[model samples]
Target: MLLLLASLAFVQYVRTSSSDQNPYLMTDYSRLHPVKVERVLQGEAEAQLIGLVKDAKAKGLKLSIAGQRHSQGGHTYYKDAVVVDMTSYNQVLSVDPEAKRIVVQAGATWEDVQKAVNPYGLSVKTMQSLNVFTIGGSISINAHGRDIRNGSLIKSVESFRLLTAGGDIIQVSRTENAELFPLALGGYGLFGIILDVTLILTEDEVYRESTVLMNLEEYSDYFQNEVLPNPDIRLHIARISVAEDSYFKEAFSKNYTVDRSLKLSDHNKLKSNDNWVAPGKLLFNINRSTDWGKNAQWNLQKHFFVEQSDKIVSRNNAMRAASAFMEYSQPGANDLLQEYFIPLPQFDAFVQRLGAIVKEEDMNLLNITIRYVNKDDEAVLSYAKQDMLALVCLFHAPLSKAGQQRMKQGVERIINEVIASEGSYYLPYIAYPTLEQFRNVYPGYEYFFAKKKDYDPDELFMNYFYEQYGG
Candidate 1:
């Protein structure tokens, strides 16, 4: 019944933290902004930073709130605005093992929550690709990792504490503020700033996972139907490996029972090779491949391991068996990536068209990744509504001339096709597409704006996306 610490102490901290660092250096992660603000709040009262809220509204200044700065899109960063740094507010408010719920402050990172719930033999239903991200940030963006069984992380949120534009503090849930709850779920922080979130946790169990190398033609059906149906299976990632005339696919899954029919010997041979390295590291070598055709090869990595429900564990190691990692793309790479989540029926055709394009253009298809997601609650901009989703991430290492050309043309053509298919691009990885293309992807941007207007009429909370698309 106890709530996290009250908000009074947090504002004072925010007031002081603002002075510790130069406001010029403060950023929301993606879009850097030069602004003046009181301070970044920490602790329970962060949710109720009435003074900061009042100040921003009083000056009719736009305010931007940030947790971990993990979002790839321009959703978090703002310029010449009051930025609420929420990192100091990290804390586990409470946990109810019997009810399978855990309350956490908005600033709390996934790492913090995972540790707190470990003792309860519980874990979140889903998490982002990385654990360093903050809980509230995940909910705002509606993030998801490789898990196809669950939708995005928003589905796990049972309720949240939010501060509205009017400076009103309220707790939101499915049963309470029902309409606004789902609206703000994937609403991209348009409704208000998330102060805290309570999520439903799953009982821990042994995760039998494995990685497999297959071709596009080989596992398209399995990805759409089999893996997405089981709620227990975690982390389904498919990456297209561009090697010479042959193209191979790398697929990873967690807590899965190995299929006896699969060629165990072949799967073992592939994993043993150095081909299975971490994704970030693979970025450096992705351009080394000689041939760039649309053919398919799949490298399968599966893990069949079990651990007690209550042990603090590592999700990064569990998410991917490889050790290669990469940073966010720098500004202005000639190449671009276009990802579309079309209806399952269009999936096969989409891939076929992509293959044809790769062949016709002689494009160096870097890596094509396909991810599956179950249907989610209604949100006008929700990308997971499709019965199944195939996220095709084509890599183009602008570091190389050929890679840059291939990526540029490939992204442009792919975006055109996606628009034609009535499919949308994921904001996180979007590097191309015109404003018109973006507007088509999010026709509900106006709806989001209306809601924001009602909550923070003064536009105290603002970001690059807000200025560009918030209307």
Candidate 2:
């Protein structure tokens, strides 16, 4: 055991040593595509941003929006374009406890929102599992999370200001500028730069966490018959085992049930930092390396969550889940995410085929998380066409050209199964799916791109995502 541990440690060290250190070139989380940018400007003031847009147009250069650059695809940047960094533009504008709403700048993260509203006993209605993502990025992607009641992130947004290609700031909402509402929400920053957002908030409550172990076949039924029917259960997420022995067979669900007996104040103090990141990263690297590590990770996760059953936590604290442990900066290899939204009825069949494909391709799948999203067709390129179960998958792959080709082929195969299951995949990840596959899954591509041309005829706002599929 000691020798095995030493060997893994040495391998991790070697991988870490080759980390990317070039400052001139830019890349997103995936680190697969690195390219040079004309310049990166800080988004400090609205006037400055508008001036920047005008300048880019005058120079006949493209503009790309960037937040934390978490989107794995090339959505946040384009080669030789001016990258507008929005992280420094974050600011909490207003919070109304009576109205259950908050207004914030586009660059503000969920963490910023949580800290501002925790005192008022209010929480975000819908967001991604982690609080580190920026509001602009989340809304651009129309993200969803463990909470099942509020639908997708777009449902929580009341209104937002968008800086269009013509240097005009316009208010977009369901009732105002209605035409642009659907087009801009999941438009991948092609429509305009989201300035600030007014979001609907919900009351923060204490809940008791519970875990249930079951087989893969039983999850969909259990969720429909048991979870959805219960009002007290607010947030729920499940996971399927990826270990060799229990691969895609064993599953477990973690449900957060309202616990009125517990005091919200007792648990509402926000966590400032992620704990045990070093050890967690070490163990996760092991999980990425060997089959033995996979089995060990599965067992450890089962024991950890099961042991914490009945633990009390506040909504804000729960949403602020630990993410530091997932960070990987290895040079030649990296972890990437791909999510597929399968209609509830087809969940079983999809998982069965998914397991078969992964095994056949010998893919290095690290994790698979299951979350629910209600039917939402409001966005132009909506992924949740119906009440669906999302499979959030994580995989580790090499960054070499040949390696990427192999990964792309495997990913395309999985997307084929997703299409056959009458499902759609998330667009924020890599563009491994062929353009034809993208059109098959999102039939509204024609209208979406046509609107882009209508709004920004010069194609002022551009990125790799548009360059790839906007044809």
Candidate 3:
């Protein structure tokens, strides 16, 4: 099986003033496009970068920013732009255990935050499955994890410092500069550079992991009836079987509930990611090509996660995002990701139609993970306008010109289906939808872009995403 491990080590780049780097070759996690830029800052101090921002504003040069570059598409890059690599500036500012809050430089990753707050017996309210993503990137995407009650990163944010296009550092929170809060929170770095972030933390309690099997039809009801009613459960997620017989017809749910009977130990009990690297990579590589391999992976996971899902672990340990399958680049293939946010009532219809599309398109469908999101009314270009299911689809596609063209056509059908169900597909993914389709799904985009003019009159913070759909 092919292994593409996600790198946590900082990238080393030579900051040379050479013309050869012009399409500024940089790629995000997708490995789909290694783009070109006018210049990329590899070893510049924060002050120097801010000066660069001012210099860009003065010379009318396009400027962009990236932290870890984990975003899928050009969410981190723009053609002919000066991209600021922000990871070097990352540092924990302070931690207030009594208030259950911590402040850190935006470029700090969740892994950094966990280490800081864990000593206080606190945990992050929510974060992506893995700890490799930078906090700034997470806030820009408004990322959410298994904690359904808290909703998204926005729910945990207290405030942050944003550097606007004019190179002015401004404080934005629910109060005082209130309008800027939502814009910066999920603004996709279009508004400004997040200098720092203050996030609310939670107790690192012991949670017992358990799994339940149910047909697709019973998911929503079962969630509302059994999952939501319990206060002990903190994390909930389910997998849709990709096997030929079950094929979205069946699902296995995993719930992590706080165990009062146990207390979290004074240690991180997670096995070294190396422990699961081989099996995890093999399972996904097989799931990419064979139904038998896919079924085998499911059965194997079921035996460990379902048959005796009663294992107890610390909240901090339960949330590590180190699975090898969800790692970095594939040499000859691309791990394409497309997420759809369907209205709660439309979940059943949406999934059924989606399954049909997969069958009809013969998509190399590997896995579908379900998550609950509450209405994110604050973000200007909010995906979760109401409670909905976020379906994260990860699949393998050949890295060829034809494969990209095929992916474009296939994702179009997916966008239409989501829109037809009164749902909107998430941005920060494949730039397949036209501006018309984008506006149709996100009706408030016009107002959002309009507001951008007030803050960024010259339109300095631009990316491939806005270039494709921000009409």
C-alpha lDDT values of all predictions: 0.59, 0.91, 0.80
Tens-place lDDT digits, model 1, residues 1-471: 011222322332343233223434554333223345444444347535776777677887766777776554456655556566678888888999999999988888876876787665566778765567788778887777666666777678888978887778788887888767867777666677788898988755434454454555656677656665665456566655455444443333223432334433233211111232333233333342443222222221112111222212233234323322233333323223446777776766676676666667666555666676667656656766556565656554443455545555666676677766666667655344556777777777677678778766666677666666665
Q: Name the regions of candidate 2 deviating beyond 4 angstroms.
A: 1-18
- Kindly report which residue stretches of model 1 are placed more than 4 angstroms away from their true locations once superposed: 1-44, 224-235, 248-255, 258-324, 328-338, 355-366, 392-412
Q: Model 3, stretches more than 4 Å misplaced?
A: 1-24, 266-274
**TM-score of candidate 2 relative to the true fold:** 0.96
- Cand. 1 Cα-lDDT: 0.59
Q: What's the distance in Å from true for residue 401, model 1?
A: 16
Clash list (residue pairs), candidate 3: 23-36, 23-37, 24-36, 24-37, 129-321, 130-321
What TM-score would each prediction reach against the true structure? 0.74, 0.96, 0.92
Q: Candidates sorted by lDDT, descending order? A: 2, 3, 1
Question: lDDT per residue, candidate 2, 1-471, as tens digits?
Answer: 545655665566556856674778998988868899999998999999999989899999999999989898899999999999998889999999999999999999999999999999999999998998999999999999999999999999999999999999999999999988988898889998999999999999999999998998899899999999999999999999999889999999999999998888888888754765656667788789999989998898899887757778899888988887677888788898999999988999999999999888878999999999999979989999999999999999988898888889999999999999999999999999999999999999999999999999998888899999984
Choose the strongest candidate by TM-score.
Answer: 2
Give the per-residue Cα lDDT of candidate 2 at 101.
94
- Clashes per candidate, residues 3 or more apart or on different chains: 48, 0, 6
